[model samples]
Target chain A: MPMHSPTDTPLFGSWPRAYAVVLGALLLEIAFFYGLMHWFA
Target chain B: MSSLDWWILGGTIALLVLYGLYKSRGKQSFDDYTLAGQSLPWYHVGMSVMATQASAITFLSAPGQGFSDGMRFVQFYFGLPLAMVVLSITFVPIFHRLRVYTAYEFLENRFDGRVRSLTAGLFLLQRALSTGVSIYAPSIILSTILGWNIYWTNLIMGGIVLFYSVSGGTKAISYTHLTQMLIVTVAMFIAGFLTVHKLPTDMGFTDALRVAGKAGRLNLIDTTFDVKSRYNLWSGLIGGFFLQLSYFGTDQSQVGRYLTGETIKQSRIGLLMNGLLKVPMQFLILLVGVLVFVFYQFHESPVFFNKQEVERLNAGPLAGEFQVLNRQHQGLSAQRRAAVLNLQRATAQNNDAAAAAAGDQLDKADEALAKTHAAVSDLVKRNNPAADKNDVNYVFLRFILDYLPHGLIGLLIAMIFISSMGSIAAAYSSLASTTVVDIYRRVWPGSTHNEVVVSRWSTIGWGIFCVVVAQFTNRIGSSLIETVNILGSLFYGVILGIFCVAFYVRSIGGRATFWAAVVAEAVVFVCYYFDLMAFLWFNVVGCLLVVALAWLFTTLQLNLRPVRVADE
Candidate 1:
């Protein structure tokens, strides 16, 4: 599906992309925390 | 402030402003002004979301919380990950598809214009006041450390943020947040490590935890569903979930963070990252405080952690009594240290009885030390009526200043300022955006002819308003971090309720939701005023009340449906 314009009825058009984004963000956060705790401990 | 300190602060702020303005050089539409044209990558959005949440108060007061209360505060974030997941499934996709500038903008489309305005107003009031506290958190440190006028410090701190926010808007705020979060993470880690290094040669990190645990500092999980207790498993999961949901899902400051993402996927990812990391990040910060608590157990600490208060007591009529208490504290510290060492040895040998006996002795000594500290603090307060008697806010800063190496001290202090800058900048941006979009643009449609100048001036106006609010920020007690959270609870539930009704209860029209919200907010305030429940419960109560009331109103309206006039 083409990306919805700003004026579209709903904001996001794709759930797959949304899920992908959330997963990717979660991984990055986990990595950041692991490094942080290990570095300090 | 010292010449060097002033130079460091001034130079850092100047560079940020110049960089933001430099990058802001372009013809920008409303999308560019507010959402960075929705072009930022996932990393930028993630950092922005993190920075917006991790305010200066997190650094300034969290360690103090640990120093006094222990690691239990970490549980406050347990609900955050779940909140993130829920928002991903619910709020993110809808908001992303809506392409709204402010979260409340979507409410109007779903419900009515009145509901949108009410939600926006709640957000405006809460964000403005909370931003004031955020500005005040760092200003208090600069004022106390440098003995500068807090009024002027508030202006300087708030103004610096306003300058950049007004210049580059959301894009500038995001880029700076990325840098600030990086520095904050590294500096905090170093500070935590250095606290352990300051402990006696025989003690290690594990030893510190054991000592802190004995001292009642490592109380991480409290399963009891005590509404009065601020940090516990239930509050963290249930109450905190509601709070976080309202904050990230409804609050424009946070909504603006994810709104900067290039795609819905990117925005959801950034939020998910936040949800996943927030609890652990909070855990680590609180752990630093717990470790600091343990470190103090094996070493002689001050009778009162607030040095300024101690100095005043020494110069006052209570000087003699204070000295006597100080001497007594020293003796108690010596006994406590010996007792702690014995307990550690007994534990190492797996001698449970001996360990218990030694632990009891250490606890007795700790009690005596606490009495001495209380005496000193009381004396200090008696001498100076305006004194900050609660030294919990200063516990970690005291340790850092007295023990940390020179370069690290600068870095840690910088970390506090950087965190402060990140959150304050985000708040400033949010405030400006809300003012311009919700109030200004709404009131004066087709007045976009002077949008840029109006936006800049609105940023300046809100900056001044927040700084003014910061002036009355003193004497808010030790848990400044918790104080902000509690304050947020006051409005977040009502705001969240409006959104919940908007997203899920399509049958509830705007007027019903709007009036229901006003009543719900009043009820929350009444409960708070009468001390009917814990502050955390307000989030749950306010949200549930709004939804229930809105549903009732809608049901009533359905029954009273007006008959349409027949066409003759």
Candidate 2:
């Protein structure tokens, strides 16, 4: 097979967008966990 | 385990082995065997990747960690999503393009054979050591449940995975992972649900969380900046990032997983999927652990969860001392249970003052209970020097055996076994591929040996090696999950640093990178040996040290030639 170059992530529009979504989700999880601890505590 | 449980467990294993053999029916070449012909789609790649990392250590030890340490351990994974993002952006394209059999092959292309071998060697060592530790985890389950000797269980655990891996190669391992992950996901979810379901009808999930929170078990985040702290946000973010980066980017066990994807997009998307799901998955698992903790508060709880060790001490010459501590433990547990019930009623009535009072009593009761537990552990150790003192690994397993419904218990045990199988099989395959492609192929440059046969032999050799490693893993100081990460931290940073210099620092050459890595590893060792800082930081420190040392060494030699791997 020919050597691959950077490929688009058609699922999330593009690679950068996919990364954004994952990282964005992480930030959201951190926020959610903080909220969870506070509400439970 | 009931007959139904036995059937579920037996049927699960048989289905897995048969399914793997079925999927990998056709004859395969070295490429097909090691890389599954690089034809798998993103979902297969995604779950396959997930299954490899979700070893028995993850299932048995992580929940146990949740029980003992609370959600603070979840911070250890905060760096994971970011690392996935970084890998998706950088490593995926390069690795997919090069089409190498192992991540270490890229090192060979970028630096030279020595660097490749050294990095691969480190991966082999750490991965083998960690795999052995994980293998020992499920063996604990079998030994506890069946009263079988652990040596036999370890051998059996390692052999079962070897059977599947040798027969199906990477394709079988990945295919089996598809089913293994499905059962694991479902069983764990049901377990969490049942843990909550078993609570008194008046108490719901939120109430359980309240109880756990008041007990300091809902500590989800710690923004502490302490260097010596193990699982604060900073360590998880920075230290975890380096560890995750090295694990996904350099470790052949994981790298080999993504390499099976048909396209770079498949690999990237699959990894991104892992990033998306892993944290939530871990959170759910930890929540189950916290719920198990809550379960014990309302019900009876063990002073030490390792029943085998507890039993031995209770029946030994120290029986008298253990009985006193056990009685003390029972009284403290009753007080704690009463306090939690009061807290529960106070919360239900919206009585903050009463709730606060109850929480205070609960804390005091826990302090007494903890002291009793410590005394018991000390006595257990004194009774038998070889007994495992840290019983966190047994917390979840004991709860399942004692509390979970029977058929589900069988399924969950099967799930842990299968989870262990997925990881061990992947480790075996990676070891074989690395040994065959990086070491064997390179050493005998023009030899047209049938590599598949050699790879099979290599798998057998590694399986035995890891099983031996399992035998020696019982003495690990931390929970098995943390022990695995600690093992990874020891080498992952230096490996990632070498890759960083290769990828981004063109002015450095192979020799400088090599010596720099050697010195960086020694420094990391000293830091870990003397407890200079938490283990997670070892990744960050080792990686930075390699890059810095490589640059310094290169500049000192005045070798200003830009770094270029073979592809360029």
**Stretch of 10 with least lDDT, candidate 1 chain B:** B559-568
Candidate 2 chain B least-lDDT 10 residues: B558-567
Candidate 2 lDDT by residue in tens digits, B1-568: 8999999998987887788889878889999999999998899999999999998889998888888789998999999999998888789888887778898888878788889999989999998898899789999999999988888999998888888888887988888888888889999999999999999898988899999999999999998799899998999999999999999999999999999999988988889889999999999999899999999998989888888888898788999989888899999999999999999989989999999999999989988888888898789789988778888889999999999998998899988988888888899999999999888998898988799999999999998999999998877656888889999999999999999998888768788899999999999999999999999999999999999999998888856343455756
Name the docking class for model 2.
medium
DockQ for all models: 0.10, 0.58
Candidate 1's residue-wise lDDT over B1-568, tens digit each? 3455556555665665676677677887777888888898878988899999998888878888878776778767766776777787788778777778888777767765666678888888888888888988887677767777768999988887777677787787788788888878988888888778878887777777667767777676666889888877788778988998999998888999998988766776677678657766887888888877777776778888877778778888889988898889889989998998898898789898987788789889878877787777778778887766778778887787777776666667766877788788788777778888878888888774667678778888988888888877666654778778878999999999988877776666667777889999999999889998888889999999999988887787744221221111
In candidate 2, position B516 carries an lDDT of 91
lDDT against true structure, model 1: 0.78
Against the reference, the lDDT scores of all candidates come to 0.78, 0.89
Candidate 2, superposed: residue stretches over 4 Å from native: A1-9, B558-568
- Score residue B431 of candidate 2 by CA lDDT: 90
Candidate 1 lands at a TM-score of: 0.90
RMSD versus native structure for model 1: 4.8
Encode model 2's per-residue lDDT on A1-41: one tens digit a residue: 22445444366665567778889999999999999999988
